[model samples]
Target chain A: MNNYWSAIVNNLDPYVPGEQTKLSNVIKLNTNENPYGPSYKVLDAIKNSCNNQLRLYPDPESISLRDQIASLYNLNIDNIFVGNGSDEVLAQSFLAFFQKEKPIIFPDITYSFYKTYCQLFNIAYKTIPLDEYFNIKISDYLPKIHKNYIGGIIFPNPNAPTGINLELTDVEKIISSNKNIVVVIDEAYVDFGSTSAVSLINKYDNLLIVQTFSKSRSLAGLRIGFAIGNKNLINGLIRVKNSFNSYPVDKLASIGAIAAFQDIDYFNFTCNSIIKLRNNLINDMINLGFEVLPSKANFIFAKHNKYDAKIIYEKLKDNNILVRHFNKDRINQYLRISIGIEEHLSQLIYILNKIVNN
Target chain B: MNNYWSAIVNNLDPYVPGEQTKLSNVIKLNTNENPYGPSYKVLDAIKNSCNNQLRLYPDPESISLRDQIASLYNLNIDNIFVGNGSDEVLAQSFLAFFQKEKPIIFPDITYSFYKTYCQLFNIAYKTIPLDEYFNIKISDYLPKIHKNYIGGIIFPNPNAPTGINLELTDVEKIISSNKNIVVVIDEAYVDFGSTSAVSLINKYDNLLIVQTFSKSRSLAGLRIGFAIGNKNLINGLIRVKNSFNSYPVDKLASIGAIAAFQDIDYFNFTCNSIIKLRNNLINDMINLGFEVLPSKANFIFAKHNKYDAKIIYEKLKDNNILVRHFNKDRINQYLRISIGIEEHLSQLIYILNKIVNN
Candidate 1:
């Protein structure tokens, strides 16, 4: 728009993230955030790191944190890379492995940030449309294999906005058949229900699994995420990261993430509670004549055939409650609602029933 | 090199930062770290922020922290851009402003990261070598300017490794003459003893000043930095940032940085102490038959005409005292020693006397 801007800057249509409303009383279900707080041990670890030692730079390699992650996932330190968030880890992956002579392929309806990253990096991409049932057809990806091309795939285990998970066997088949390409399984919400592909990483050198602490770990504000992959692929990402920024994780973030891994009991308890709440919420919605999809994430995607989705989103907003509604074409009719605490979900269902009856 | 990595990754020779040793008794002087600890209020603020609220994501826009930075610099909020560190800020600037038809220009021996960033972004650059005395010759930059060439310019104000600062008038002359090209002044160590160019931000639209809390505010472990420039330029960076990662600064880092700005007395006192110790150390080195450069930053660059620089460095390291020595061609004779506390410097001087006398 301006003379001082770069050519790519003017062409970029940046992704608009879900609204983070600051109103204290609003029932915020817009972003898929965990309702429970982080474990007490996470707070203590952060406190322990915030002493007088903050004057010096943190470990540039993030060795201790990486070692902890490697142990938790049963992978070596050489097979893992950490960043400020999963988004950053994805951005580095795109630059490291996705840019090729031919276009990469991904589902048409997917995380919006992936397209935005392609635009920023000038990577050519082709959008393969999902089937009528909103499921990714694996056959569509097989045809795009070419000599000059590189494959970069990222679909949430329980995909975002739609909250439908692909079976772990299907994922394994895709990686095995397309041995020449790289397949990334984003497990941001996998802790809720879906199976993780992390266990299959050793079998497939082209498989890269991304996970975050924002959702199930309940440390979204701390900004930590990681990628588990083959040692060579992990080394490529480290090269890109070292060339870009040395210290991506701060003192508090590193300490809090390490402690989050240490407290396995708290993590299991909180994630289990969310899954239970999600199933109950789905039952309530279906009984009320809402078309809810099969969900395995911390959120559910649903629509009322009689009520317009935009109208429902606005009404909820007016009542000081927030839910996600997309303006994009194929998914605009649906609403993505996050699973909150018991009291918050009860309030949402009661209000929804009244609105539908009226 | 791996078969899956992009072609660009294979060509990159990434920058290697100075070592961060974990020895307890060593007087660490390799990287230019602040000798004193961060403010007590910064530690308190970080502790206060590590709570249940971490279950939610931080403000992606970082509005409050930007407001604090704007208020301190007497600039509008739109003119400020923040990143994980000055290194990231500089990298973004290279992608946003320096990828023009002509190559960018920088000192051949300035911040080593500048060359590394150029390679990472695939930007063409021509290094304007410093004069024989290791000073940035303004005349060299003026003569090389042409219409279809010269994207921008960047160098540390108090040039790194040399610890010398350019006059404000000389910098302004460069800005006025090269009105079409962007000029970035990296003032990472300016707060130690030199003046700042933040006051001239309103006068020149093409000028961008980058600074960090790592050197001045003593919060390096927290990873925070900012760029002050025209609003249009800042917005260009925001587009790139949004495409990459939304929340580069985490919740605790934002809160800790704000507290750092609030404690003006602590910041000023620490900087003053470092300045005094630096001057005393320089005098003592000269008295001991070493040639020390006139420094405006926290570190001193010195070498002895009688002894081998590498020998002296190895001797100091053997005694558990660390300092930075570059193996590069031009600066192989000098050692960059950070100014620590008075007692640390006294010990260093005693060891130096023994080495020289022996």
Candidate 2:
């Protein structure tokens, strides 16, 4: 810790993202990326955009892309706000709407980045524990808001690591009841299984739904994500954004993301494939003596009753397979594995059977 | 003025970038964009990068691009920090090093974004007014650093809107005298003319020089920039960056930036052309009865005593030519014109001659 650093900088415990290992043969599944490629149209659009026009800056407002997103969601242009990624959009939201006299609230076991953001922005936060069955209790969150003031709320629809989704009715109840506080729904994996909160955006002015091309749309490396909310909330974020970085989405990202939205058919097909593979993977794991969570995301959280998770994780690593194993208490027994292609799943099942039987 | 918004959000006056008009025929000379395209190799690299691999997230560390920049600058990898753009890099720098008991200092007549950033980060600042000739007085800056009170210093080299560069010797003197406070030399337009402080990074640990691909490398649309400094300064930026956004640069941007570095010959050729054109354009403006600054950048700052800059700006817009005229009080009389291609400049001169004669 250097004395020259800011007080906030010293206090930050930055989130460590998954390892981006360059190994050619490793069975990679840690980061829950779609195994399928982005649409051919996205690549074509990116190639077309690589011209002398790149000498100029991209549209600071990203108007055309926002229009396309608005059209897809049946919302007005004022409802949309885009950024470098959903991470950036979320970061801006925390700065714009989450910092207040009161503490923000979220699930105790949710996206780890929410806590990281709180540390960065110095936003006070309280994590309400989920139920004994690892389900989010809307009742628990509702009463806490009355007891202690809440600035905002955020939880992934089909939550990460656990991969279980809260029903849409439950989400609507929480959002409608908490009209005074901003409610952010991160739909990074919504396209895989659960319904999007975008339809509810018109009804709930305080509701802000954040989505990313990184997951179901398969454009993680392009760095594009956006939020749909009421015009007032979008304007608030745009103000913070314009103050921070005028042009967050680069030209290539803008063109590619717009094209990704245009190719709706391709998006649906790819997400359907992932959902089908997810079900098959779950069955295979259960047959191999592993207990799997009811997953709505692209990845599964599971643990074998007989074998130690850390040991199993190490054994898989030795065989050139990579999966995420959290060492934190209460969740150390489970490993989060992303759904890969059919061939990758077959290989994973083969390896797991060998290890479990031994 | 929503009640749910952050208190700081309501107080912000966001920076307004120069207009990027979508009109095609306008001789765009507002932002200091390179008059030529990036190297063919750069485009090719981006094309090659836009593949199925986009499914996975880019390297959060961006090690390959960092190593490429480090090799080009003859510095260790630890001395380099890359970001979405120099704007983002500067924003991070303000958060990382520009906070202390004392106020940060900058020229009164300089990049307006400096003040905007100060406001965004809530950084206390004291403006050191430029002299009558619009030159920063090093003496005024040096005397104020007693008691180790100044948090940091930042100014554009060949300062924007004036285009007069601080001598490298003078910069070294300041760096030597102010070893305790961080001194940032923003070299966004350094590649067009003048020497760089990057060579002195090893000798002065307190110096951090920021540069951008937007001006000289013609990658504004790609949104890439970097900072060169001592390891300690770079490490501080990395900590803030990781907490903020892990993957600021996308796949295509990284590949294109690396390729731009590789094609040194192409880079030199394009920059030389812009320099030659800039000299010619400045000479022509003086001949047409204009008071021009001694420019050491890709643009020139000039004013015609006979013509109100705003009126002239409006007339130029009518003639399908666009130039920047700041509404700020001090710089209101001036028109900041970016050096464009030879054909574009010839047409602009022709239009100016007609306007002046009439």
Candidate with maximal TM-score: 2
Top candidate, metric DockQ = 2
Span of ten consecutive residues with least summed lDDT in model 1 chain A: A142-151
Give the per-residue lDDT of model 2 (tens digit) for B1-358. Answer: 8876898899889988889888888899998888898889999889888899998999998899999999998999999999999999999999888867789889999988888778777889989889888998988668554445678888999899788999999888888888878899999989888889988999998999999989888899999999999999999999888888889999889998999899999989988998899999989999888999988999999999698889889999899999999988678999999999999999999999888878
Off by over 4 Å in 2: A143-148, B144-147
Where in model 1 is the C-alpha error above 4 Å?
Answer: A143-150, B143-148
Estimate candidate 1's alpha-carbon lDDT, on a 0 to 1 scale.
0.88
lDDT for residue B156 in candidate 1, whole number 0-100: 93
User: Taking the tens digit of each residue's C-alpha lDDT, what string does model 1 give over A1-358?
Assistant: 7777768888998988888878899999999889999999999988987887898888888998999999998889998899999999999998888877677777888888989989988888888788888898876656454332545666667777788898998888778876776788888889998999988989999999899999999999989999999998999999999898888888779999999999999999999999999999999999888999899999999999799999999998988889999988888889999999999999899989888888
- DockQ for candidate 1: 0.81
TM-score of each: 0.98, 0.98
Q: Ten consecutive residues with minimal summed lDDT in candidate 2 chain B?
A: B140-149
